[model samples]
Target: MNEIPAPVTSVGKTLLARIEDRSAVIGIVGMGYVGLPLAFAVTGAGFRSIGFDISPERVADLNAGRSYIKTIPANKIAEMRKGDGFRASADFTEIASVDAILICVPTPLTRHREPDMSYVVGTATSLQPHLRPGQLVALESTTYPGTTDEVLRPILEKDGLKSGTDLFIAYSPEREDPGNINFTTSTIPKVVGGDGPDALSLACALYGAITNRVVPVSSTATAEAVKLTENIFRSVNIALVNELKTIYRAMDVNVWEVIDAAKTKPFGYMPFYPGPGLGGHCIPIDPFYLTWKAREFDLRTRFIELAGEINTMAPYQVVERLIEALNRRQGKSLKGMPVLLMGVAYKKNVDDMRESPALKLFELLEARGALVDFHDPFVPQIPETREHPEFAGRTSVSLTTEALAGYAVALICTDHDDVDYEAVVRCVPLVIDTRNVTRDLQGTYDNIELA
Candidate 1:
């Protein structure tokens, strides 16, 4: 491990001037879900943006006007590539051309549930060679408070480049909500902080160019903590509702109805619903990053750990519900029963399948000899997994009475707007609605059940 760098001298004035004049060349690293959209938004906002990724294929795709990320349109990439000063490449030699850089890689969890900083560290190392004076580097990857200080700072300062002084370094966490049609990269409020005043001002000025709102916190650690707090609050709240859902089920109460009624109150309560399990890159993983980092501080985050445990158990509970549903229909268990899963995408609309609960549900069902077939209109080919065969060439069937008649039981995992509830209720024999897509059609389907 290398020593962390100090902030650059007069960084605040220089960075502010450069960003104001649009002379700051923005370099975005790890152009995945978060990076790509940000790159497009920044480039479209009149700043010259350069995308940097280690994957040659990703760079090639971007240069060729092709986008692998679902939310980022290929046409947008094409427009950016053809636009005035937008370029993407795998070569680190072009890193010197960047005046500002954002690190947007995934900080995924290890098998042991520890925070994996390999990608962040690797990205820092790659950019070290081309690091120069008066450049502002912001880490947008979601991790613990000390990540910017403990992990990235050392890697960037290995060549004696001072941070906050020679090079302004900050941590401005990216709040990218994938599959969200309403809020986008430009609309969402951005949180920015850094080691000192110089780093903070630079980050604020830079992000202010793209977003309307910029929240300047005290330090980089506090900014990192902000993202974790947002995610952990969600995790804990969802776990609370999930726990309540189980109790309500035993009491013969529909949790969805309860939530709808509670939502009407509009004053004291905010509704967070239950599902098969916590899915997506943030809810399932972000809290654990905080808990893992807490251990280093000799602090035990019991709330976070307990929330994680409860949320993780939800998938198995859902499988049990499916088994119970099958037992009522056909005197047998999950074993050898053909199950059709509806919607494999993590959320309702967009096509990002990363960390989707549907995959976990499918895997759990298949482990018990239950035949599982998934249909997600957003995702065409159901790629092969560790447990399932290469079920490629599969596509979403129209949610009509005739199309769903073959399946014995249908599990509604993601409620995409295009799916017709009336048609699904009329067709599927038995339905396990995790997302409550069938709640309104309860009177229509006598066989519909809620998990």
Candidate 2:
């Protein structure tokens, strides 16, 4: 709520010099998926990184050279610890030791699908006591525009410490794609927007060291918008294909096959695959953030909302398909019938199930009187989620032949590479292929059906 602080050159210049020489100690808050990779990327660029987390377990794991995230191996943490490159701490007082602090916390949606700024607000409040005049604070969480200037600025400036002048404030949203082999934090180009010229320069310098490129936008709001735009684009496109999948399904056409052939054109034709529903932290959640923010100006995000509606209905449609398949194949009612979800992770080969449709599918099936269990090589036990806490503590059953035969139907929610798709087709009586993992073995088995 404070006025945008005037840019002070002296502190900004000193910080820029420190970043350039790799003398700057970077502080990364929330040592989860995004923060963990970024900390290593910072250290890889020769900067000593101190990671901060609220979880003592996470801090203990990192300090002991262990990794909770699947993609980041334990040996990598060991390598980072070799020369005291990276350290994770629960103490916020350590915030004073770092030159720049990046807030990489989650911006999850509430039950009403509204932006829950609790994590961001809580993180900033915790850092308030340790906030210094010369330190930089950059938010790497995906949020709507004005979050940096409006939401964070007021909270950080609550004590009358000017943001742009004293504490350099910036918003450089994290574009972390978990389990992405092609792009790492260092390879991804970072988009940065600062409160002012001084803040921008320091943020750019800090990110510029770790990343291959830094896209300096005009203001903090613009940077926030960049991340939302990226996720929204994917959300809309995926929704389009999901809609197409339904239309093509009624025509007895394969959406996966259509996409495979269509992508061969290779010009003005980028293929986005259809899924059971929108999953991950971004596609399912970010568009709603924009739509929620849009309501403040009394404007409706019709396209985004429609896309959201379509994606939300996806799990229901998939459940209906499973119901139909069971009735048609076995001539048995869904009531008391056992169903197995092949994968619980949001995406292939990743243990992240933040908003995975598999959980939604589980709930939907169980609500319809079907007994549902899951079998994911990646996710052995369903972790506690705010929306689906009822599913928590349920362990994944083995995909053995006897286990597969016991289920009335198997739904391939996620197409993890390690899964034996052929074995699933061989054992399961009815298979609902949402991800088309059984595309190659279609002729071999008549039991497989596309969701």
Candidate 3:
């Protein structure tokens, strides 16, 4: 229902020229998983990039050429800091200095499972006073369909700088996959949408310089919808596989084997493996944005709601499997037992633990009187998080054979490549493989049991 804005004014044309000429100073707000890689990509494309974060510590680390995220090396940060290519700041007043601004803030959900758009709105409001002509702003945060047009545009236009005229605005959802070595930020296709033709053209040109492919959509809302759709598809598919895993387990059939066989059919099948549960910044959270927004139209997102329900229960199912395996194999109870949890991060090779099902398993195990210890090569210690503060003091235990043998059972929550599965199977008395990490050694080890 949102109307398109006017054509590009002289100010927008000047900004476009600067962007095309590679002289534009690119500013990335919220230098976390998404923004940091983007800043690197922009700087690598021969444009000056400035990273902005509210955390002074993060700003200091980036300014010192130190990498906090594991995927981005300190050497890369040092290389970017070597001239005027990249810098980090906590000051919002410096927004006026950048030619283009990319908002990459988080859009998390409230306790009631509604969209919490405070980060996006707050960043837009903070940049309002610094709004000027000949500057382009693009929001790269994932959200509901109308967010770029409804939530951000009004806040950005409050300073008398009209979008597409005195200023330009666009929505380009970020496709950053942290710890994914197969695809870098530059390799992922950038999807850009805007209020009008000029904004779209400018956004495409700006992102096109960094990435190999730039997909331009008609409206900003459409671009926002694209990100939601992609994540929702993943969430639903993962939920399906997880649900099937339970059914297959009940029937004495291995779901991993079924998936491996089904994936060979190239025509109509796309393989999505089951896991502990959905994690990271996107899959578990982004789908609810659409679920909340759909209620406005008096429509129910049954699939999204169902997928959320199933995925949320996957960790509990894993715990049940562990309990069942322990009771049947060793005639042991969970209470007072020492259990080793392998890999605490959501996925392998990354330190991010946001909404990780492994944390849920840890909490559940402790509640059931199981003494739990975790081992993750990437995460040395559990940091204090907004959601799981109780796990703050826990640190990663060693993965030696001596340490593994001391535990009553070992649960493979995440299949990190560095973990020696053979040693784990040999040392641990009972092994609950939630990730099917020991599939190759299914018959070799008497202790290894797949969940």
Highest-scoring model, TM-score: 3
Shift in Å, residue 224, candidate 2: 0.8
Q: Clashing pairs in model 2?
A: 1-154
Query: What ordering of candidates by TM-score runs from best to worst?
Result: 3, 2, 1
What is the Cα-based lDDT of residue 158 in candidate 1? 89
Tens digit of per-residue lDDT, candidate 3, span 1-451: 2343334577767777888799899999998989998988999999998899999999999998899998888999987877789999999999999999999999889989999999998899899998788788999999999998899999988868787777778999989888889999999999889877778878888898999998888899999999999999999999999999989888999999899999999799999999988889899999999999999999999999999999999989989989988999889889999999999999998999988888899999999999999999999999887778999979999888778889999999999999898998898899999888898888887888887
**TM-score, structure 1 vs. true:** 0.94
Q: Relative to the true structure, how large is the alpha-carbon lDDT of every model? A: 0.84, 0.90, 0.90
TM-scores vs. true structure, each candidate? 0.94, 0.97, 0.98
Decoy 3 TM-score against native: 0.98
lDDT of 3: 0.90
RMSD of each: 3.7, 2.9, 2.2
Lowest-sum lDDT 10-residue window in model 2: 1-10
